[model samples]
Target chain A: MNATLNKPTSSTDVAQNGANRVNYVTPLANILESKDGYVLEAEMPGVNKDGLEVIVENGELTIVGRRAVAENRGREVYRESRAFDYRRAFELDPSIDTTKITAKIDQGVLTLHLPKAEAVKPRKITVG
Target chain B: MSIIRYQFPQVPNWSSSDRLASLRDEVNRLFDFSWPSRDSGLFSGWSPALDVFDDKDNLVVKVELPGLNKDEINISLDKGVLTVSGERKQEHESKEGESFRSERYFGKFHRSVTLPATVDSTKVSASYKDGILTVDLPKAEEAKPKQIAVNVA
Candidate 1:
């Protein structure tokens, strides 16, 4: 469970300019474990449905959210929010049923449901 | 023109780190008031972070408030001060499952900023998209920067 948290992207993997390297911030995430499986929720404040992607590959889950920068807004008098994208990866457990995983985004929050594999679920045996 | 590389360390929160973070933010806010360029606010619940920008015609303010319904937000401008207040409620309450991690903030939040220039209050427009609230306040005609021509002797 510890390994399934936020994972940062390596600098080498991105196309970096001398001055501009795409910045990525790990979105705040919550994970819940139930008898069925795990529920993961992430907060990506500026991302829209068109800019979100969730991929599962090689027993790993990755979520990337792109924030569209509005240009020509003018000279900034004050700033607290930074212009950055969101990226987080998680190493999926073998017991998770990747095929049954589901994801949805609403109001910049992403919720993912990862169900456990049938063979991994606890089953009660009856006397013959 | 430049991309910023900002990455936060990935720390597992076996403890209540969210409370610690909010406490740190409060401390920062206390010190931040000395610098007008960086001011969030001192609110009881949570305060949403915002940015202020001014072009020739308009002053644009953007606030980050995620997972909130449109009706939950309230915006008002009085005497050159713009205030944005909102409430973000948790979507669901579950008792059947156990939570491993919870990091998102849910509560009422309020933020206000005094405009640098006078704006046409009637023409102010606001829009909420992708969990971001953008308030566009058009500067008054008299407050716009005027260019003067000088004749060379």
Candidate 2:
């Protein structure tokens, strides 16, 4: 019984390449798989929507943004830890429909939705 | 001014301005320095948001700024030092929950970077679109790097 359920899981793995090297130097990201698509969540602490860029070029996805240092022209200062920039990139798999991928930056977190191709989506067949 | 004296052990007297200056220095040391080496609190992680590429006569700096208001951002170049500064504010309430998980950063931040060579500040152009700030710094005619070819006789 376990073998039957595992058969489909093995094929899904073949369709996805999860071997992208994680860059610890930048923000940490979490990838989630759903019934219809995959979601990517990146933690961009000081970044805002205006500072973020999501680009799909040459079949690769890249996210870039920066957090500016606060102006203290003539003011006194205290403990500080503001960072300059945030940049990350990922090579996409062929199973993902690049044209259908959508990205939204809300707050400092960037969320990307990559919809699987119709042929790759799981479907239940009916026999009359 | 009313003077109240309280005796403490091993306490040195410091002037008000001196104390304030020291405090300011401490804050600057903590927040206004170079890119952070590690991720700490929100806005504390460092990444090269701006990648500057120089080719002969032109210099391009691509800056990444997300969710920041245009009016709040200021970019200026004076005496060869390029300064970028802005502020971000936190929201008062949230529907997620009374105790919320906030990874977003809010407050002021500034970065001052010196240019590689003399640039024509008047000819500089900056455009912010799609959450990226691209600053074009045109180099002076004499400052552009010249390619020298070697001839073997």
Candidate 3:
């Protein structure tokens, strides 16, 4: 059985850019394990592959992207509730092979496949 | 002489409307405090996922954005700052109550990144494949490392 828990904590200092005032709009991600590899899924609703970025630096994984506002409708709007600048980071495990990491984004869900190294894969022993 | 008595109404649990109202208030407060204080059009809430590493030629930025079409994303560079922005829409579904928890991000997002060094923006290229956006920022000619040769007598 695969069980995961959700935890929410305030991260105010992560992005300190001055003009953009939206807060508490952090991207949520989930990590899953499969027989072939570990998969990471992130929800990025309005972002496309062009705006999305994935990188590995110094044993850390980072994903960055932006959501552009639509053309003005020429109507006065009272309130808006959309988030931008989805940022998230993770510390990659040393056991995983960084070179073999593969990622894909579909339908606002980003999926990453981290295949296990040859030494970590399960091996079958034969008895004569 | 007359005696007067007043009975106070009991307070109820916060209704959905009340919760939504409070959420709106909180959002308003954020804007009130942040908008009037900055001079540079630099907005405060852009946070993009970034990974920095050394490559053979340049530093690459890969971002993940799903549910967005290729035409929606825009990339531009001005005065050494890279700006990426796009929008995503929500699908319409007739069915309701199907989701136990819904926290997926929706709407417009903007991210402006300041490069560590001057980049060769002319040679920069971006590609989107399989919902992943990859931006290759080539290092400037002068920024590339030079090797020196030494002769010993």
**Which candidate number would show the highest lDDT if scored against the true structure?**
1
Give the number of colliding residue pairs in candidate 1.
0
Score candidate 3 by DockQ: 0.07
- Error (Å) of candidate 3 at residue A115 is 32
Runs with alpha carbons beyond 4 Å of true place in candidate 3: A1-128, B1-48, B93-99, B151-153
Task: Put down candidate 3 lDDT per residue, A1-128, tens digits, no spaces.
Answer: 22121233343215656976554335666565544456666776556677788988887777776664433322221112233467776776555688999887675677777776778767788998
TM-score of chain A of 2: 0.68
Task: Find the candidate with the highest DockQ and give its number.
Answer: 1
Model 3: residue B129 alpha-carbon error in angstroms: 2.7
Q: What does the lDDT read for residue B75 in candidate 1?
A: 99
Q: For model 1, what is the error of residue A100's alpha carbon versus the real structure, in angstroms, after optimal superposition?
A: 1.9
What's the lDDT for residue B24 in model 1?
Answer: 78
Better of 1 and 2 by lDDT: 1
Candidate 2 vs candidate 3: the TM-score winner is: 2
Candidate 1 wrongly placed segments (more than 4 Å): A1-22, A124-128, B1-44, B149-153
